[model samples]
Target chain A: MKKLSRNQTFMLITIPVLVLFFVFNTLPLIKGFMYSFTNFKGFGSYDMVGIRNYTDLFTDARVGKSYLFTFKFAVLATIVTNVIGLLLALGLNGKIRAKSALRGIYFVPRILGGLVVGYIFGYIFTYILPALGLGSSMLSSTKTAWIAIVIVAAWQAIAQTTLIYISGLQTVPADVYEAGAIDGATGWIQFKELTFPLIIPFFSINLVLSMKDFLMVFDQIMALTKGGPAQSTESISYLIYQNGITGGQFGFQSANAVIFFIVIVAISVFQLNFTSKKEEQL
Target chain B: MNKKNKVAATTNWPVTILLILGCLTVIFPLYMALVIALKKPSEMTNDIAGALSLPKSWSLENFSEAMRVTDFWHSLGYSIMITVVTVVLAILIHSLAGYAIGRCMAKSKFYKFSYLYIVSGMFVPFAILMMPLVKQTAQMGIDNWFGVILCYLVFYMPMNIMLYTGYLKNIPIALEEAATIDGATTWSTYWKVIFPIMKPMHATVAVLTALGTWNDVMTPLVIMSGTGANTLPLAQLTFQTQFGTNYNLAFASYLLALIPILIFYLVCQKQIINGVVNGAVK
Candidate 1:
């Protein structure tokens, strides 16, 4: 070990992650990517088809709907979760009784698996709520599926977002707010001038994280809707999975995945750059 | 001026209302679920809404039946195996790789390698490879609890490296350097000096990993669909069937899924708090 060269050291360390990545992810990813350019079912050798997979995927309405639904969910979840979460933080931040226990109660859902959540909430959505006259098919129908999914997504995410907001809120300059108060600044005005400006970074965190969350909303959809009453809840993750695994359209699925990959990477890069700029500007 | 003061006081109502609403929103679903879980099948279908209240007669029958039906003890053990092994292996490998990549290796290659693994890890969504990952793992004959553990490492390794590396950047190398000078080998120096020092990160990673693997359903569902390898998540997914109208057993099982995590979250609550507050938990 002492006699090992720098290159040797790199090999020693990088090899584990790299091997695991290659065997598990990178290789399959490449295989998937390559197959996307071909006509491979899960069976034998695949033909080297051209851009057909990409063309078909784009031309398909259901495929396009998945991305749109995913994007919409991400947007709504980010906004709702952050706004509510920030409000929760601001409320809880003040001298409150039993804050710790309240925090634990709020934080419980965050700790449980999403499948459990999906089941628990699925029971609520499909059964319990209906018993109380709330519509049961909210998740099943196209018109209200968006709101249902966003609500569920927000419910699962608010605790973490609340924590983030609390962290962000703690660093706000107390004196600036006091001065704003002296100037007869109202509650809304103080938040607009003080809280909003200083907490822009937290907002960015909330946005990007929600993006991640929305993109990966699979188990919930799978459990709750299975992409249906009429494909209302189709999402990118679920779509890729259907194409790749269930439908066995490996080539088309791979194309969808690669495109999905590019979209995600692009969004993440854009978010990072955009948020940093906001952080600087604010 | 007095009107303005009154207006300001009235406006704060939104915050107060939102605070109570947010807490209720967070807690009531779980509360509802718990209420259902404690009820009998007879109580469930008779009145779903009424079933959400405390049971007229609190019964441990649903729990015992849930335990028997889901084969709760076996799956619990398997869940423990999956969580413990994945958490240990993921942390150790990541910390080692993080330390070497950050300090021990040459700058040029290290930077490129770091970006290769960590950055790409962030961009590609897991759903893209989930299908193929399942197939590949099945092909490798690890489509069981062990497979679940390995899959977790692959799924979570990126996160571990990304987190530990970020934390390591904040850690000074002087301690490791001093240890090396005193004839401590690289491994021991890492174990004694570097590892312990990264305790916050360790605790964070452990809790995070445990939370993740314990809560995981998709990976297990995809890969380990075989008998004798079902996780608590898979059990919970089918909980609806076991007590379909009996919201009690369903929610009971959901709460059971939650018990381990709640214990985990409480035990490492401080460490988790430190991690969340310290920046990089996300």
Candidate 2:
């Protein structure tokens, strides 16, 4: 065998992975961008229509509605999940008995697939809620369906967020709380100044992650509402999937997708920057 | 501090009760699945309490039927295969690239560019590439398990590489330098001297990738569509759609899909939770 230099050996091992990344990941992104400008509808040849797909997106009400619903859902889900998760972490972080088992119970839902959670919650919304005299099935109308979607998404995500928060809580030195107590800081005050500031990074992580996930929500929507009740809960991901795969409007959906990608990237970058700046400021 | 502990040890009962109730509420949807899955078909219609009602007679018939209809064992095997292969290969590839980037290739221009290229992928949002990915995979004659696994490998690479690279950066180069002085090849130095030290990152990467692959629906939905090689999620989707009204079987399928992952999580809960916390904190 030839004696390969260190750099050469590094290149040899890394190239295959890089090639696979390029072909499957980068290439699709590039092709998706290219296809957005054309009338390409699956196979065969197509002419580039310049910015027609892009311009047409403005006229697409479903895409707009999906974005609106997705943003609303993302915000609601993120807030609910983080708040509930933080509360759970705070409670579990204390010297509770069977704390590990309780923590495990809290995180159990996260291990289930989103699709499965959606279906399970769908069952609850459709049958149990009505039977319990909680009015009609929440999924029967646009407004209520969006609530169900948010609830299911939060349910699916809360466990992981709680776990993250618990870890963050565990990191704050016990002395910090002891000193706060000695200085006559109440429980709420201590949490605000000590626990909250120390765990801000974990908060940012959960916030950004939940927002991104909720915006791209698809499988759950598919299982729960199927974006029904007049497509009230069609998230960006579901909208793109519907338009591209089921509706055969690949080009138009690709345009929506490209815009969606830009929006998500912008949001993520902005969130990280904003949060990190806050972390430093605090 | 003594007062706080005394309060936590005594007057916290109500709050602890509330926490238990809250945790129960969070996990209620999953409990619903198990309840419905255990009920017989006749009981499902008559159970007025719905998800809250315990089955008068618990049976495994629904499970067996769900297993038969959804091809649960086959799909489980397929999902396991895909997750295992993708996770193992991704870790190996990412570690090699990460090792190179964090060590020998640290000062190279390619490393700088490649670092930004790979990490930028974390924000690209796979929805943007969905349509093109579907077409590209079909065109490549790999719209099957191979294609799905390949997509997972590519989609997951950036995060895995980021983790491995960041972890490797903290280790001193002295060990590798000593190995080099002993005339060991670059490859052996990584495998023998460096790889073993990456146990924690490996744990993080493994848990992260494994959970992602096992729970992912969109990629498999797009890539494996009509290929008749369904993973567990896809199989459950098909089962639900086909048996739209059969709540018994649907919930059973959902539970069947959930059991393996639940077992896995329970077994590796500590490691997985630690991995997630470490991934976020770092």
Off by over 4 Å in 1: A1-11, A44-46, A182-186, B1-21, B45-49, B104-106, B238-244, B277-282
Candidate 1: global Cα-lDDT? 0.75
Worst 10 residues of 1 chain A by lDDT: A1-10
Clash pairs (backbone) in predicted model 2: none
Query: How does chain B of model 1 score on TM-score?
Result: 0.85
Stretches off by above 4 angstroms in model 2 are B1-5, B9-11, B50-52
Q: Which 10 consecutive positions of candidate 2 chain A have the poorest summed lDDT?
A: A93-102
Per-prediction DockQ, in order?
0.49, 0.67
Docking class of 1: acceptable
Candidate 1 lDDT over residue span A1-282, tens digit each: 255544565568777767776787787777677778988776677788899999999898989988888888888888898887887787766555566766666666677677777766776677667777785657666798777777877888887888877878888877776678788764688788877888888778877877787778887776677787688788888887776776868888888888988888898999999989887875
TM-score of every model?
Answer: 0.91, 0.97
- Least accurate 10 contiguous residues by lDDT in model 2 chain B: B43-52
Candidate 2 per-residue lDDT, tens place, A105-179, comes to 887777778888888787778778788789999999887899988888888798889988988887899879878
